[model samples]
Target: MTAIILAGGKSRRMGFNKAFLPYGDKTFIEHQIARLNKIFDEIILSANDARLYAHLNLPIVSDILPERGPLSGICAGLIRSTSFHSFVIACDMPFIHEKIILYLREQIGGYDVVVPQTSRGLEPLHAFYSRNCIQPMYRCLNEGRLRIIDFFSEVKVKIVDEQEFKELDVPTQPLVNLNTPEEYQKYCDYKAPNQRES
Candidate 1:
């Protein structure tokens, strides 16, 4: 199966483009695209400008609807993916666990979406989405409810509880979002110097 990396956020909170932030020697998008490449048969990128992800040498698709938030990105992936289901991840989450991701995909065979439930809430960004979500997302868009949570009622969702996520070799901070300059700095500091050295 393929995976979609959503790299089209406006980055209003970070005060700069989120994709360009350096994880080490490479940009944040580069780090994520590289990681996803190691697992999925195809790593698709959904961004405002398709050329931005061309450096990764994979399929890069433009957002189906610009500035409409994540639903547009998911819509774009749903339309472009060759697989019935595609795993999706937000570009800002630097600590994504590959083990948990594989586990989630295993549970996606009979479900349209495979989401993980953490203490904070359901992680829609790190979930699996099916083609069935396309129309409901359009309906949500037309109704002015662009939030990812808006279409949960329209598809089969397998919420992997916290215990399931614990099987990951390393415990992951499911929602360590780097949406601000301060948060970015902390993440940069926390990552061991040689870790993201490209």
Candidate 2:
């Protein structure tokens, strides 16, 4: 399977590129790539500007529909993906564990999408997408239906609820994403002590 990182967001609330934000010893994107490399053979970066991530030496794909939001990025990734199924995640989510990812991978059989639903609701970015969803997603983008879940009804969506997550000892931390400076700072502060101890 392949891994797709969505990094094309405007990051208006962050006031800077969230992908470049420091998580521990590495930048957010770098950390994600390092972790994903251990699980996936191929990793595709979905960004608006390929030049920004050219140094990473991965396949950086720009949105085919341009600025249509994450749904557009997912479309681009799925189009470029060599695998039948791909694990998609936003760049700002730093706590996504390998166990959670492996669990999602196991649930992908005969499903177009295997998404997790936490107390916060459906985590579209942190989900698995199949090649079968390509057309429905493209149709959504072409029709200006930018919401990620707009095409869910047209596909075989297997929603992994919180109970399922608990069975695997998975917590909501994996779905916690930093969208604002305050959230970023809070995470940094939370990790500072752990960093020093290490």
lDDT value for candidate 1? 0.80
Alpha-carbon TM-score of each model against the true structure? 0.90, 0.94
Tens-digit lDDT string for candidate 1 (2-27): 89888888888988778778876678
RMSD of 1: 2.4
lDDT of 1 at 92: 88
- Which residue pairs in model 2 clash with each other? none
* Clashes (N, CA, C under 3 Å) per candidate: 0, 0
lDDT of each: 0.80, 0.88
Best by TM-score: 2
Pairs in steric clash, model 1: none
Highest-scoring model, lDDT: 2
* 78-166: candidate 2 lDDT, tens digit per residue: 99999999999999997657888898899988999999998888999999999988899999999999999999999999999868867
